[model samples]
Target: MRKISVQNLKGGTGKSTTVVNLGAALALKGKRVLLIDTDSQAHVGMHLGIKHSVTLFDLMTIDLSIEEAIINARENLDCIVSDKKVAVLETMLVQMPRREEILRLRARRLKNLKYDYVLVDCSPSISLMHQNALLFADYLLIPVSMDVLSLAGASSIMDSSRMLLQMYEMPLQIMGVLPTIYDGRLNMSKEVVSILETNYKKLTSVLTPIRTDVKLKEAAAAHQTIFEYDPKSRGAEDYMRLADELLELETRLDRQKQKPAEATLTA
Candidate 1:
């Protein structure tokens, strides 16, 4: 399965919103998907309308098998919810041998679990769990609000990732920088876009930015994705567009990989 991580150093930048909507959109397109909420807040699960005591903690520390914790959130969409009790994983980790290596093992298991995509919603902080998520991720997408402070936080996240690469190899590449909660009427939002495009053109993607819609927050509160809540809404439409861009990027990567292999054979 291809792994994607939705991450940002600072909170409230639409990280969970991006994760749920993208996963829902992919599932709507008939792809088998697994969404993992690594945030201790368990907000992804709440958005999916799943209430459970067991969560990633069960998958990692408890006797719960992967299948046991996996919830069928929608047709072709499955989720491993985060628990408020997930803080226990950190406490539990101290007793385990090779604590940092546990996530590597889980990721290997997930690769064989018959999924087209595995989308991880990482915690806001750069903890051990976040490190493991980044290591397993094939691509990382950061959701940035159109503000100078948010952009500054994005830079810090990039720096942290580079530092983490020093401790363990990071096989993942940045997918793109996404603009979230964009408002065309707001000069602050417009200025943020300018700064990002000027500073991060290499990582910026071509997908259209998601406009700030009141319906998005409503959808989350209703325990539904934008598509499920209101397919006609701009939020749903934007996520669909983003999903298409991601699929196209994957196709390009596949072609790029094949070119080297073909050249070797021709040589």
Candidate 2:
């Protein structure tokens, strides 16, 4: 399964929104998607209208199996929800051995499952939980809004990822930098996109931006996904395109991985 963590150091950059909508879009295309919410705010559950007694905290602090913590939120989408209780883990993790690897070790069980994608919605804080998300994920998906603060958040994540790579030798790759809430009519929005493309294009892809849409906020307020709220809306269309783009990128990566083995055999 492809494990991706959607994170930004600043709040309101659409991290949870991207995770929920993108996961839903992929699920609508018949992919089995699992979303893990690591944020104390628990926006993922709110967006999906899924309430659960057992959450990520239970899975980590207790002996609860990962499978048991999972809630089937939609036809092809499942979720491991989180709540305010998850905040305590930051302090609790300090005393635990291999704290950074906790999530990764626990996630190994997912290999036995049939999920096609695992998307983690991470907290905006720099804590043990944040480190765990980075260490657990194979790829990092950053969502930057049309603002300087959001861009700074994206840069912070990139720097942190580089540090983790050098320190732990983890093979985490940048999936892409996604521009969320983009308004083409606004010069500010255009400028932000340009800056992102200019700065990050060489390191990773600057994906198709998700246009500004009131329907997205409405969908969240209604406790539904864009696809579920209004399939014909611009938000829905953008997320669908994102799903396709991500799938294509993953396919290309897989083919690239195979080329080295193919060369070895020929040699």
- Per-model TM-score versus the true fold: 0.90, 0.94
For residues 1-267, write the lDDT of model 2, one tens digit per residue: 999999899889999999999999999999999999999999999999998999998887887678888999999999999999999988888999998888888778898998999999998877888888888887889999999999999988878766775588645477899999999999999999999989988666799999999999999999999998999999999999999999989875676456633311110
Q: For each candidate, C-alpha RMSD in Å? A: 4.2, 3.8
Per-candidate Cα lDDT values, in order, are: 0.79, 0.89
- Work out how many backbone clashes candidate 1 has: 0
lDDT of 1 by residue, 1-267 (tens): 778888888888999999999999999998899998888888899988986665888777765457777888889999989887776677777788767666556656675679999889988887777876777677778889878767876787777776765467543356778889999999988888877787777443534688898889999999989987899999998999999998887876576456643311110
TM-score of 1: 0.90
lDDT of 2 at 75: 93
Query: How much does candidate 2 score in TM-score?
Result: 0.94
